[model samples]
Target: MQEKAVVYINSDDSGRGFLGAGGSQALETFVDEIAQNVIDPQANVSVFDRAKAHELVDASSAKAKKEILERKGSRLEALGSGSDFSSFLQHLGIPTLNVGYGGEDGGGEYHSIYDSYDDYVRFKDPGFKYGVTLAQTTGHAVLRMADADLLPFDFRSLYKTLDKYAKEVSELAEKMRENTEMDNQLIKSNDYAIAADPTKHEQLPVAKAEVPKLDFSALKTALDSLKKSADKLALSWTAASATDADKDKLNKLLFHAEQQLLSAEGLPRRPWYRHTIYAPGFYTGYGVKTLPGIREAIEQRNFTEAQQQIGVVAGSIMQLATYLAKPL
Candidate 1:
């Protein structure tokens, strides 16, 4: 089996966008590099085209050109469980890509008998334009992977994305604390009873304990270290002096980087799904829960568990940084 790259083209007719795909760290970068370079023939533009336009439009006139020039190629969604790429990415730690096209086609015939070829042709892509487009897009991606001298894996992007998730989890904890405090205060003051009319019966909210402060120092420190290490790795990889053996060793390390983010014990009550950074929400099912271990624990108001998970996730981040910092 080829260790270079893996691409999966899944049907996406939800009208959200062209396609939303993701994978483990190395795979995520591999797919994104291909998507950014491959031009969308139908639109007569690169897949990165719209993102550039959006950035330019959002920026001030003076900075617009600069923003467009510096902007990275195609955006990638975080990979959650519940897709064909799950086993290849989450289990085997292979570089995998799940691709598809959508955003102009919308329908409600999913999983029904009406979801036939005729229905698709009539309601989805008439004349099969999108089908051909998807073929072209994924085909180009496959060719690029097959031909590239070094596997394209962007550790910088991964570090930035993970850093964002860490911030989000910290913010989530603070927000939960604030909300809990507000609720407790409202109950203590009997505001609910005061707001109710004498003629109508009302049940007052029960008084609850205030949420305790969470320690995010460890997580923050780990994320900072990870970012520095990632920056160094990215620089080293892009250097002209780097050799093929160096690239190969770096790629191998990246391939297993995502594994460090997984815990043997898994998220609370969800042992089968082991990704700490991204996982399918237990209640939302298909929806993604970033920093799942910490986010879900806080969501359920399990402060003790949340604190424990925070340390666990911090350790994982530190481990990943160590791997990247190791000499190639």
Candidate 2:
């Protein structure tokens, strides 16, 4: 058995994880940082961020274009299963990333007759330039990670990502509360008139139960602790000057830091996925659900479960923070 895992990176020319790549914000930052050094004239790569709307980051060779990549959006989408990175990140809590170029091709090729040489030249990659650039870009990522003195990881970025997810879940609960109240008010006012046939009287739908306010204090407190711990780790690592053997030992600890996020019980009903941070949508087969326990509960209108999941996710985050706080 291996003592520790360094990192996991999955790159596919055709198939990739659903929605976007699965990783901490640091992973996206690391990839973008290295990609800037790649001088590719043909394949002007643009990065899509964590947001569903996809604020683009142009990681091209040009100076103006490359600078814009960081300013706009600089994070990766939460990864879901259906690609190679799933098992590593979800099950084992390995620090994972999926790197590839996509979202540009307009769906037509299926590796079938439509994907003929003529169509490929016109629609897909024009001159196989993207392929060359892909090799160069991915190559640099691999080499840098393999050669870095101290496992090129930054926990501070991860703490910020967790903070963002916590806020998003709180907002999700709030929005649900607002919508539920409005719908219930409409029900009381008897506003279920059929649009197609106003004359055809229909039974009014039963009023939904009012969404109660969820307590997010636990989550907020946990995130605050995480921020402090992450900052401490970052500051110490920057100043440390250790022997090669000591550095290797520290790298091993960093390698397994993500494993601290896993819960023994796992998500609501899925025990196989232990990580609290990223998981496949139980219903949206090909899509991702970040902070799955909390997000999915809110989405399914299970406020009770949502309340409980907030604690679960908070505990997990706190555990990760505590793990990171250990002397480096």
Residue 208 lDDT (model 1): 63
**lDDT for every model?**
0.70, 0.73
**Highest lDDT among the candidates is held by which one?**
2
Q: How close is candidate 1 to the true structure, as a TM-score?
A: 0.85
Best by TM-score: 1
Q: What TM-score would every model get versus the actual structure?
A: 0.85, 0.84
Error of 2 at 201 (Å): 5.9
lDDT of 1: 0.70
Model 1, position 143, has a per-residue lDDT of 76
Error of 1 at 79 (Å): 2.1
lDDT tens digits by residue: candidate 1, 31-146: 65656775655566665575455446556776766856775554467767667766655554455566666644356677899888788777676777767766766777777766
- Cα-based RMSD of candidate 1: 3.8
